[model samples]
Target: MTDTYDVVVNGASVAGCAAAVLYARRGAKVALLERRSDINAHKVLCTHYIQPCGYPVLAELGLIGELEEAGAVRNSAQYWTRWGWIRPEDRVGPGVLPHGYNVRREVLDPMLRRLAASTKGVDLLLGHTVNELLTDDGRVVGVAGTAGGERFEVRATLVVGADGKDSAIAKLAGTPSETSPNNRFSYFAHFRGLPRPEGHSAKAYYLEPDNAYVMPNDDDITVISVLPSMERLGEFKADLEGAYRRFVKALPDAPDIDAAERVTKITGTVNYPLVVRESTGPGYALVGDAALTSDPLAAVGCAWAMQSAHWLADTTAPAVLGHGDLGAALNNYRKRRAENLKAHAHLIADYATARPFNHIERFTFSAAARDSRMAEHFHVFGSRLMSVPDFLSPWAVARCSMVNGRALLRPRAQPVHSGERVLTGQGAR
Candidate 1:
């Protein structure tokens, strides 16, 4: 059987949904395909934190009100470094936009999928898996798929590959993806009744060499994640619950996660490498994880996906509606994404190797932990309010250096067992 649309998107996750919805809203008929039987499904192994940069897109899509109504919490970020806790600076002035949202993918993903399905020009096909790209000459024209043991084809003027980190469409389209050595594994779960830190914000506690993040979502539920290097995965996986508890307990301002009721089983992913791929080619484009995926420590995935969708829609709408060339539009999309995120990617890629922070990072974080003004700047940086270079201005670096230098000078006390190490023995943390 054959069907037709103006654009066919071969994934129904947030990125794909965003593309479909935006295209549909622009008056193009869109077909959104997903392999999952449940259109409301979400990626279970995600942190689900939306950065501030994604707010404009959500507001533009008219989803802000709905998301908040659905119990999404507005929050800032706190960094728990070994030096001390770096909370947002209150003196930076009031009336600033809140940093980001700590949401559960279980809730946000379904909401987004439903919104896309409800758009006027969208045809959402769930439980259908794309088997190959249907090309005319050398240009991608549509997709072939299977649903209910039957073959089907969807022909369109353009095809979008938003099938995520392991995108088959991207591979079929001849787009090469490069994998980096992320050798990091993460264990996460939801808990209730754990005392949230005194402030209403998400916290990233840097246990250097390892890290833990406590993100407060809607209701009393919080998402706590531990990211340990691959070499340490065995120690963590051997006794997941115990290791998790120990990690939480070691936090500077430790939370009572152990005392709290376990609301979900400990879930983990092993050796998840970060992947980035070229996002555009003739008659085709990619969005979200299909284009790029980095470590989740930054919590920018959802926001980047939503924002990229909006960008892709704007760039492609003109061409799809007869105002520009589809190939040129896709090329433009690639340029835009690269210009916006390349530096960010470079920084993350470097950090993932667990390299010791340069003098600048150490200074900035330490200063932020000492001064609210600096902390606010750090928060803005964390929330994507500023770019990396801009956030690391000469003045900012100097201030951080001065403050950190003083702290370094005042530090005293030598450890009696400086080289002592804790060995993992098939037990929890």
Candidate 2:
């Protein structure tokens, strides 16, 4: 069998579906292929925290309303460090910084697939696996593979690889990729009745070489994740359940895990290497994890996927519609990917080393915990809304320094400890 489209996207998860829906909505015929026959299957190892940068794209796709209607929790973040808590001034209403959503991928993935399948010009082909790129004179023009135990081919003006970090399309297309090792491993699961530190707020603990998150999700469910350095693997391997519970239960301002019921089996990602692939070539492009899979600790995967899809569609759909230059459109898409993500990837990769916080991080974190304005800035930057240069301006640094100076002159106060050292497993402080 054979099919033709203006764009053919491989992998119908977040990125592929977003691209297909957006492209078809823009008047281009698209074919979205997924290897998994089960449309409802979700990524088991994801935390599914969508950042603010993804809100506009989600809204544009008309997914935000549906997500909210499905009980997605709108949230901001609060961080706990040794200095104290960094709480940004709570802002009410829309258009605020550090705002995002927490909807489980079980709901989100199927929703995206259905949206793409129902879009006017998309053919959602589940159970289709691409085995090789169909090339025309040195440029990828389509794909050949198997579907339902039969050979098939899909031809298109553009080919997209959204198959994730282990993208078969990317490999078949020979896309150059670079990888950085992660020094930590992650484990997380959903629980019911876990107490929240505040209403609909996500919490993070920066415990030097280890970190943990309490992300509130829809339907009164909460996700608790711990990312401890690789050296602690033996502890987790010996007894993952007990160590996981004890670790989270010991954090400062920790949630009441004892009061909660474990609703899901634990999921862990122990070898998630930071991967960056060349975003575009000839007649092909990449989005989501196929393009870049940074440290999951930043929770940028889902957001970056949708936003990159938006970038790809916004830049290249005109060309697909015969209204612009294809080569130039491809160039613009490449530029967008780099300009938006390169710096963020650098920071995420650096932190993936699981090293202790650097001097500047300590200085800024201390000041942010002391001052609301600094906290807001820190949150904004951490949310990836502000560039590193802008966040570390001389004015910002001077103000943070002032905040720290004022704190040093104040009388010493009793230290805040949860009951024990969670990371080092030391006795009560």
Q: Which is the leading candidate under TM-score?
A: 2
Q: What TM-score should be assigned to candidate 1?
A: 0.92
| lDDT: worst 10-residue window of model 2 | 420-429
TM-score of decoy 2: 0.94
Task: Kindly state the number of residue pairs that clash in model 2.
Answer: 0
Candidate 1 per-residue lDDT, tens place, 138-256, comes to: 98888998999999999998899888888889888889788887756788889888776544577787766677788888877888898877677777768877887887787777767
lDDT value for model 1: 0.82
**For residues 1-429, what per-residue lDDT tens digits would candidate 2 score against the true structure?**
778899999999999999999999999999999999999988988878999888888999898789989999887888999988888755432235557799999999999999998889999999999998999898999999998899999999999999999998899999999999999999998999876655578889999999999999988899999999999999999999998988998999888877899899998988999999999999999999999998889999999999999999999999988898887999999999898889989989999999999988988999999888898889888877888888899989999989999988976545456656343222323
lDDT of all the models against the reference? Answer: 0.82, 0.90
Give the C-alpha miss distance for residue 83 in model 2, angstroms. 0.6
